[model samples]
Target: MNGAFSLLIPVYRGDDPAHFAKAFSSSVGEQTVKPAQVVLVQDGPVGDVLAAAIDHAVESSPVPVTRHRIEDNVGLARALDVGLTLCEHEIVARMDADDISLPERFARQLPVVEGGVDLVGTGMFEFLDDGGAIVARRVPRTGHDEISRYARFHDPFSHPTVMYRRSAVQRAGGYQPLGLMEDYWLFARMIDAGASVENIPDPLVMYRVGAGAYARRGGQAQWRSELELQRALRRIRFTSRWEYVRNVSVRGVYRFVPEGVRKIAYRRLIAKG
Candidate 1:
């Protein structure tokens, strides 16, 4: 609350530009602790509507909004890497283009970060498209030791709901190109490096989850990415041999399972809102 933070967001051509812009602008506007600046990174060529939406959000925002454009579609990890460098504040909060951050989100996260936590995230309420209905809630592990232990098998924090110290991220080598698991990859390394991490027990963001969300988490490509992440964790000694094997086995079951089963698993087993 006392110090300003930068909201870092990445926008790609695939997103619904108008929806994204509106959600982002409204969320930022509603925050109790307004950001000093909002850094919006355009990852690739966007259509006229999306481009115009970006411009409108920037022009209408109460706080200054800085826009960065990449020549081509560079994907989330690289786009975030670039966005991180553009952040004007040491404390940077990550927001997805489509997710809605609750009004009190920054108010709650700021104190945690300022209290010496290198990275702080919160639980999230997963909603349907347009946030018309709530589907699930994801409560991540809290505390440094608990988070480090949880990281051995799963992501201990929600990426979109995180506020991390810029220096801590840079010290951990920034974001890497790890496909859909990029956030998890970076968090794993940060934990390995002994960065202090914590999570607020309350839900601070409305995470939009469409019908196809779980399907996107499946597939051969995603499986390969998860495997790669597991290998990385093994190399970092974040996971022992048995833990790595168990992780891969459990993840594989979820990945190769039927769609209906996966949905049930995600809503019931995985997300504990």
Candidate 2:
């Protein structure tokens, strides 16, 4: 109801301890409009060092911290599916363990949430290393109509920069374990379920990228995932036959392309420098 919201962050064994600390500090410790609670989800067993970092971050957080641990590592989508249940507020803000949430992220997003938008997401800057120079800015469509139109082709929201109402997410069937296409699939369903969504074009989170991010993005596994996603979209009536064909033709080939070529396509065609 009010601007109060819960910050949800999922951590896994693969996360860097140092990066997690910085992420926590930026998302919770230094927020201009603080969250009422922080829901930290440990997807699986982490190293002792990482566990200690989590403890330290929790102890240092300004708001009440609640942690949930899963017995096995279930990947991001499932982790978030479980994490969403632990959130205690109507509004929930998502943050990644390796990304930096700008100081005004909450200040800029909470008002939109309070104003009755079911979900709101913002653009993000991608960087290679810890707080390094930005390489690209991925900005999504800002209005509801544009977002709905864009969702037919690609994800209209940046996952880490989203703040959404819990009820709306649940009403849309929550998150599914859909490999790399989880966020895209979930958002499409949410839109179909009639959830009002909007995106702020300004970059609010600094997304961290690995050296091999582009190279790792494409492969047989990703190709299969993309194919399944397109089919799911068609099955759900989110994409017409023609749209599905177009998506498969365009997005599917990118998955199996050479690393250098894929990188060029992503940087030059998808992301804005």
Candidate 3:
């Protein structure tokens, strides 16, 4: 395959490497236009099982696989910043360790990136853990204007389903170490920086949402991050002051509320969207 894009994935010890290997195997082995390389960032030390899985994936990959190892876990944002620098291609596609990229993902994304879009993301089919059952389908706003408008309240692009121009991201100062909202943070900044961003109106990835996903969203750290993100958006003029306050008031309550309530809210509001 003569694709000019590279797949960048960051893996940490907490991830199930066996499951990751399955995703990696499918992404590389089944892509309509294979990537120039697969840059896998090892964020920290992993167990023998995870290590073995990585080794097996590297050995079996159809495209060249490069591994960048960090001794300590520095989180996803920082890991991706490092991974972005190691990407050999100008266009980089982000993938989560356990998410499956559809076979036509690259083929569909390439033309858009090559056509001058700085960032391109697609809709996703969210599945329960192990991906046996369908949970929900997320069809993000497709046009730049629609995405920019929706981004005021919610993330307009799915992180794992995004393909971004490396230079555009670097010009936007790369990824910031924002807790749960790193991708949102970067995308907001990119929009502020005048980057051309769009979303394909197709589900290009299968996202794995585990049972504890909603529970993980509630907590003080995530709350603080959400507030910070809102403030940043307001500062960048992405959202008005009133919108910022409204977002913080509603999302803040959701963060501090009981996990059960948060889960229900997430299911009703977020998952159903």
Question: Which candidate number has the best TM-score?
Answer: 2
Deviation of model 3 at 143, angstroms? 0.7
Candidate 2 Cα misplacement greater than 4 A, ranges: none
Give the per-residue lDDT of model 3 (tens digit) for 1-273.
235789998898988976798789767898888898999999989999999999999898888988999999999999999999999999999998998989999899999998889999998888888636877878777788878877888888889999999999999989998767999999988988899999997888998888788778888888889988898888878899888988999889989899888877866664544
Ranking by lDDT: 2, 1, 3
Q: What lDDT tens digits, residue by residue, belong to model 2 across residues 211-263? A: 88987789888888999999999999999999999999999888888999998
Residue by residue across 136-209, what tens digits does model 1's lDDT show? Answer: 88877787888888888788888999999999999999999975799999998888887999999799998888
- Flag the better candidate by lDDT, 2 or 3: 2
Candidate 2 C-alpha error for residue 117, in Å: 1.0
Each model's lDDT comes to 0.88, 0.91, 0.87
Residue pairs with colliding backbones in model 1 are 137-273
In angstroms, how far off is 152's CA in candidate 1?
Answer: 0.6
Residue pairs with backbone atoms closer than 3 Å in model 3 (clashes)? none
lDDT of 1: 0.88
Please say which candidate is ahead in TM-score: 1 or 2.
Answer: 2
